[model samples]
Target: MTTALDTTDRRARQVRQALWIGFALQLAVALVPLIDLVTFDSITEHVRAAYPDWSADDVALDRNAITWSLVGIGALGCVGWLIALALAKRPTASRITVTALFALGLVTSLTLLSMGGEGYDLVVPLAHGLFTLLPLLAGLTAVVAVWQRRR
Candidate 1:
């Protein structure tokens, strides 16, 4: 009997696929945080009316953090994202970068919420952040292990 392919190679190929998928997920979220800038002020006004305890400073700080995060992490992480797909032999580095980027995304999201954003409750945004985080952590570790073994 003959196998269709090398199991190890097939696994590496799977790892490659996962790496790309994780990259894709993060890519998709590139716009999630931006919604704040366009709608935050209006939302915060309503929130303030509904909940008097909410502060104006919270809105600006949250808005600024999330917006900055969208720009910085979303933009800067592109290189790492490309590397995850394009690197022939540096999947480890790619994965590490991907992990870091996802982590950054999560932190950014948390920062946006914790800093106090009356614009919106963090439940939805935090949910999205978790979705992005899972793949990044899992795929990055897999990619790194595979690359390390490959070498």
Candidate 2:
């Protein structure tokens, strides 16, 4: 038989685990962009190979824009994740973080969809989309779990 205190402690543990999962998802989101930036040359080379008519200057310009955009987004994600980590002990603040992550995911998805076929190849775009989506799902789950346990 579980007492109210036992149930509360169990729920608290679940929330903490969920929050950690959220942090990990955000960390992955943050790293993906940084990885893209670091591997820009390789990626561009592949892109150029795919489209033989694209000039080096054109590829460089496009790659630059994409890399910078990714860095900016990733930086924001890192900050948000860090804040969420800091707020793990505060359920309300943690819920806010989840909300923020959902917003970020929506924005990223819209931007990517609007870009169409211009910037990156299919794989990069798909990967970015997945990165955003996975974190959003994690955030949503954590938020729901936290909400259910609110007293």
Candidate 3:
């Protein structure tokens, strides 16, 4: 009962949905870093507690640097996802956007994983681990869904 055009429309809709979900996930990832920027004092306290010998001043500085880095990266992710969302209707642009998002997701995830030992604090580790995995899942899903569609 479904014409070719109907099938195409369905696939397009699915791709659009996937891209938007990916955008939302990326937005969540972006917000997590902003949250860190605001609650960094608690993180510093955790780090200071874990490393007694480390000065509070030093811990605070390190925490600030980490939080800033995350914020910057997260902002970049938001931009990438926004671009992808905007281009979702154009097959080539969509593919490029999807690929870029996947690459960013991979880099971001790996970077977060590499910082696993730095979590020192329970909250830090948990937040970092969860955010890292989430982006990877969302990016992969978006890429696969888009890739499988007929252009």
Task: Name the top TM-score candidate.
Answer: 3
In angstroms, the error of model 2 at 117 is 7.3
Task: Encode model 3's per-residue lDDT on 38-151: one tens digit a residue.
Answer: 766555655677667877688877677666666677677778777877888887888887897788679766666655454353434455546756766767777877777444
Deviation in Å, model 2, residue 25 alpha carbon: 2.5
RMSD of each: 5.7, 3.6, 3.4
Candidate closer to the true structure by TM-score (higher is better), 2 or 3:
3
Model 3: worst 10 consecutive residues (lDDT sum): 116-125
Question: How many backbone clashes are present in model 1?
Answer: 0
Give me the candidate number with maximum lDDT.
Answer: 3
How far is 103's C-alpha from truth in model 1 (Å)?
7.8
State the TM-score for model 3.
0.77
In model 1, where do residues sit more than 4 Å from their true spots? Answer: 1-5, 36-62, 90-125, 128-131, 137-141, 144-151
Model 1 lDDT at residue 66: 47
Q: What is the C-alpha lDDT of each candidate?
A: 0.54, 0.65, 0.69
Clash count for each candidate, listed in order shown: 0, 0, 0
Residue pairs whose backbone atoms clash in candidate 1: none
Give the range where candidate 2 is weakest over 10 consecutive residues by summed lDDT: 118-127
